[model samples]
Target: MTRIVLALAQELAAIVAVGFAQRDEEVHQADPATVAAADLSGVDVLVVRSEPRVLNAALVAACDRAGVRIVPYATDAAGHRLAASFGLALLTTLEAEHIVHHTVPPHREPVCGGVIVVWGPHGAPGRSTLAASLAAECARGNRPTALIDADSHAPALAMMLGLTDDGPGFASACRAAERRTLDAAELSRVAQPLRATDGACSVLTGINRPGRWPELSAERVTACLEIARGWVETIVIDVAASLEEDGEILSDMASPARNAATIAALRSADHIVAVASADAVGIARFIRAYGELRALVGDTPVHVVVNRVRTASLGLDAKGQIRRTLARFTNVEEILFLSHEPDIADGAALHSRTITDIAPKSAFAAGVRRLAADVLGQPDTAATAMPRRARRGRKNKPAIADVAGVPAQLG
Candidate 1:
């Protein structure tokens, strides 16, 4: 049975109070003695108005001790600071039925999703394409995922995937987050749905112009991801290349910076995917900036991805040579090589589709599938044996890293 305690507007609270055990009692916590006497036993949720006289820190702490959730009702803009700071924001009671079904349960743990940030050093290293492909592959495995473009500089996901910016983008999410009103159902409504041949996912496009970078503040982005984690299974975010701190030179450290979004995404990520282009210039850039990355995200496991591996740039045995070069400078455990293949990537870009949808059989696509498998923590066999059955008298071979050009159409 669901347990609740309502203390907001009487008639409004009664809307959801119907068909459930109702307790018409007023509990006040003006002082320590009153709070000590107040009982919150047998209550899973405590819905209260944002009033300083009634819902103070002491009462909130008492609810926490009793394992009772505090949810605000009819909370205004001024009250958001006090109400949102402590309230779970998971209960709608009667307004949103879907939220109640997804979040409000008496006997189950709330869903906590993993955040994956795709980051690369300064220079084009195929971050956007890899993020989209990974999201598609995760969705193919029946995990609900959302692809987010948090890249502030040179945001190009909308044009790459042929999505319109008229709908709510990442900026809207940040605004909603700042107000502490962003929820899973609202997120699902705002995000653009992406459907592939075999699976489907959601996409939150980035800002259209570089001038809109201020919209994605660090605090708001963190708040948004926190709300999303309660419902989504996976969130793949594509962030900017530079991870350097923002507003360093500014006397006022509180001033907003354009790089805040990228920094926030990196800081909040459960795991990170660092895409490094396989070339002299690309490798040099990765080597130079990787140290800063380590300092910024301490103790976070970063999976290395060498993109666009071509022997033309670095003569024969490119994979072995690149691996040796990285081993000399950085203490990396494993490297996932994603070779350049233009046909499939170009085809997907032309049709505004994911590489997983167009090039399901190519070595590049297979590599993406393997990366997805690694992220999901399933056996290598889960991706080794292709989900699709092979044609008669033909066996599907494992993915091979061919020294070729990485497609730039979608990258």
Candidate 2:
């Protein structure tokens, strides 16, 4: 006994009536405007015409939540060919009689691959560096990886990777998604190849200007991420640092804002890497931001990473002290520490390469690799290496240190 709601025009109503009669299924008529607001708890199918904007992201999401399959009807009274334009299944008058008898599978959300969102509080916590490193490490394996520069405020991923910012990157993808035409192929075209990584990684650069943050609507960003999941095995998103929603009181819930992209990414992420610098100010800011981060990514596993760890910042027993502080203040038991190596970092940035590519043996690279391995549940052989002293005679050089027993393997 299939229960269906018919929200079609006058001419198509008769066809749906006959179809339900022939199939012996229960049918209820609803106004096109009221269909979205109507209760569809017990309904299995929702037959709507292509008029009055029946098919849209919100309506589709509502129908999916109500366990209803939306079937758009294309008839003379409902503006012919509208269904085809919207990429919806068109039901003609002739087929309406048997459409109710056809078995349509329940709407199943597409399975997304591993999605890691690197986020942090305000201040440069090396979020972009860690994100790129994680993506590069994932690309080292057989699975394909994509690195998205979602920082609409300061879009430097293109500059960081030494790629041209003129290409149609993340903003373009969001536009395509808003038009409901973003597919796996379209995403592949919008994502540029990271040439330095030998095509192992694909990068979707951020906007060229900070003021263009409004271009990335939350809905569109979510849609783009969905399409990206279909195109790659792993995705690493470099999100904005500030997560505060300042305009919530004055702005519409669906309207795009500066934090919309970051919030959307956090909501859609499988895992979140919350990064914080090892300095005192960074630690304080992260502590204040942790509650908000947990609220945004409820029930999602968050891996805390303390970037740029150094003895000068946190004293001799830096790791032990930081771990104890975090444990005492918060419930975070495990924290990954990435060493502060300015020379290696600057060298990689100068050459437009990832830490893994330019200095694979560096502590920063080793920490990122270990983090990736932990995320993927794989054993990390790089952690077994022994630390070596930096070459003598280099001025303003800090001693190479080991992170979690993984010695720096500087080339």
Candidate 3:
């Protein structure tokens, strides 16, 4: 009897997870040639990992010759094309993580909850700044929040916030998948608590090492977000810029990390903060990047943040000009302009401190506060308007404040 042979690359084993094994009739580890031979005999399906570092086409075609369906777990665009060409169902992280690992029941079973991803189109567009600030703000409002650093190639959120040696980040999460122990609860164990100096609710900071890229796959990313959503009321993602390069090195839009992180976070986002610089080049890139992001994200709420805007320069006011320009091309209705606060920028870029803490009175700090108000859907309020403190100092039960001007309250 020819049995279905499932050959998984070592790394892909963790990525596709063991749930696939349960879904299949028979699962085994074998070289590509062996799978092809089995397929020729009578194997029904060949589940393989399209990890280029290990598996290749010769192995893929071997299965094809056997008239067996080749199911590959892959993430790149190329993988999708290859799977489509071979009439194989591509196992993406989107469905794989959710189906394979189920620890707690789905929190938002019928209705998905809120996920806020902070993304920047190429360049150093203050994505990190906005992400950190938003997380802090949400937690301060007594809303449970989880901050995820999905920038696989350049994972730096841990270092930026001084979170150290807690548990596995993306890479460690991958290993959990390999052991078949990677679940929502396991992820919570590895998460590092990042609380502001003011003792607000903390955000989870992931691993900071580039050597741990393998841990931050699309599957684990989804898992982390899933668990975070259930535990926290809001999830903030600090995404990297896109990876693709331009000819003659003309200019790069968004960081490679941003694109990868954005795609990975799409299924989870209730809101997205698209960060951009205020300069002409930044604006141009934002216009283009916005279109691409919308195409990928559909009609999700996108709040635009124009960072480092100098009031004196560019003739017209920075905020007004950005809104008018964006309106001309994109359908984004909400735009938040943050004045250029050089003092805070110096501290953040060099010292790694939030503007609210360092230059609490600077324009940049005020902008961040205003942005926070907008995020909560409240009218801009004075800085003295602090988050209500708990009477008995209970960490879980925080006094909630309504953002006065925001049209609606986020659940």
Candidate 4:
């Protein structure tokens, strides 16, 4: 038998009589004040009146904590409309004039498609470079990918991918989300297609001005991501450096709005790629920022990408030393080292192209490809595979590293 509690006002007493008469159901009626303080143990469902103050976040949280499903009760048209807007199931008895069975919209779950968020600390840690490369690599592997430029302070994905930023991109999508119209069709229309050579990837450019960061709120960003998932196989988001929330903790009106996009991206990400430069200062900054990243993205898998890995920055055996240090000092277990190839990177940037399109055989490109493979959990045969003789001919091929401490060779 289903044990139900009717936490409704006295005006909606007819629901109690009808519910109690139903076979195989045990119903208990209580006043709104009593219901608020009552122990809801062993109750399968709690039916409450659809009042704004009574159906708030705090009440919802309480019901969730007590393991109860809340069903809103409404006898009047105004209350019914308000209940429907709150996404609640309205319950009415047979004695009511008409049974309005309003179908509640289902909660949207994160798509099966992979969501990889590339983030890093301040000081130009190559966050955009790594995010762009990862997205391009995924697309090159035949995965329909969407690269979101979510950097509120400095939006550079458009310039990096050679796409015009004048059009409606991420900001437009956020506005659509705010208006409750964001969906697969809207996402595809706003995301600009890139001129990638090997595979196709759509770019959702960021705000052209830094002042527009307030527009991309955490809720809106999350909505955009949910809509983008329906249209793509992989969603790669390039977030801002700082994860700090600027607001007064005591006042809701003074709450932080900046960095909302970055925080939302990290929170919603299936996997987070934390990129950090491979220099003394960069490493120090990354080490300090690592704790904060972990705190922000609790229990979410974070793969470390140490970019610009060169002997000049860190002497020989840089990978091994950095790996040991990260493992000992931080919670990082998987570390991918990307060597600095200024010529190749500069060429791609100069021509507004991806490294994969310009120099597919470069070590830095190869490292990024490996990182993409790790993120997707699949080997990128199309881009990473090379002819045996061609592979042998390259004398300066960076030593292929491992994933999760296992040694492996990169083709």
lDDT for each candidate structure: 0.72, 0.74, 0.57, 0.73
Candidate 2 similarity to native, TM-score: 0.73
**How does candidate 2 score on lDDT?**
0.74
lDDT of 4: 0.73
Better of 1 and 4 by lDDT: 4
Residues 88-159, candidate 2: write the lDDT tens digits. Answer: 555654365545654433453232336899998888888888888788888885567899999978877899
**Candidate closer to the true structure by lDDT (higher is better), 1 or 2:** 2
What ranges in model 4 sit over 4 Å off? Answer: 1-113, 248-256, 380-411
Superposed by TM-score, candidate 1 places the C-alpha of residue 306 at a distance from the truth, in angstroms, of 0.3
Query: How high is each candidate's TM-score?
Result: 0.71, 0.73, 0.58, 0.69
Error of 1 at 304 (Å): 0.5
**Best-fitting candidate, measured by TM-score?**
2
Task: For each candidate in turn, give its C-alpha RMSD to the true structure in angstroms.
Answer: 8.5, 9.0, 12.3, 9.5
Residue 117 deviation, candidate 2, in Å?
0.6
Candidate 1: stretches off by over 4 Å: 1-113, 386-410
**How far in Å is the alpha carbon of 2 misplaced in model 2?**
3.4
TM-score of 1: 0.71
By lDDT, the candidates rank as 2, 4, 1, 3
Q: Which ten residues in a row have the lowest lDDT in candidate 1?
A: 401-410
